[model samples]
Target: DAVDQARNFQEMLKFDGAVLTKLDTDAKGGAGLSIAHATGQPIVLCGVGQEYDDLMQFDPDWLLEQLFE
Candidate 1:
């Protein structure tokens, strides 16, 4: 459903990239990967907390660490 919605939004907006929010939650954020694969656009940013400063550039290494650790 998220992939489908992302595809639809991509068609309408033609966004260059995505900003994934709520990374501090229990969610492993596999959908971010799915949406990126579906839209062919990278996730440029991620919100790790509820503050503005928590927004950070997307880092593949960090995601890998989180996934493996």
Candidate 2:
């Protein structure tokens, strides 16, 4: 569902990149990976928490660690 939604939005809007938010809430990282793959776009940023300062650059290794941990 999320993948399709992301793909559709990306196609319609033609966005250059994507920001994956609420990773702190979904620690598994499924949505992030799926959306990135479906949209064929890089995840340039990730939101770790609610605070503005929680935003961080997307790191595939870090995300994989979170997913497997």
Candidate 3:
């Protein structure tokens, strides 16, 4: 696998939002957060469980709505 590719992609990016899969299985979401931030990316998505597609996409404006809601 291209481990370097992930790193390279991380390095070249400025600050793209990201999503991490398998968060339940993942330990404290540390690795995913680390990798995303390490690549200069902000995590904007997360998985809630072990389903095939149990993802939660964080919208930037969602925060605004929540605050107003």
What lDDT score belongs to each candidate, Candidate 1 first? 0.92, 0.88, 0.62
Order of candidate numbers by TM-score, starting with the best: 1, 2, 3
List candidate 1 segments past 4 Å from native: none
lDDT of 2: 0.88
The model with the greatest lDDT is 1
> Model 1 residue 49 lDDT?
94
Per-residue CA lDDT of candidate 2, range 10-64, in tens? 9799887789889999998888888877888889999999999999999889988
lDDT of 3 by residue, 1-69 (tens): 233555777667744766767765753555664676466667788776777577778554643444455
Tell me the alpha-carbon RMSD of every candidate: 1.0, 1.1, 6.9
Task: Say which candidate scores most in TM-score.
Answer: 1
| Model 2, runs deviating above 4 Å | none
For model 1 the TM-score comes to 0.93
Full candidate order by lDDT, most accurate first: 1, 2, 3
Q: In candidate 1, residue 17 scores what lDDT?
A: 98
* Candidate 2 residue 10 C-alpha distance from true site, Å: 1.4
**For residues 1-69, what per-residue lDDT tens digits would candidate 1 score against the true structure?**
989999999999999999999988835779999999999999999999999999999998999888887
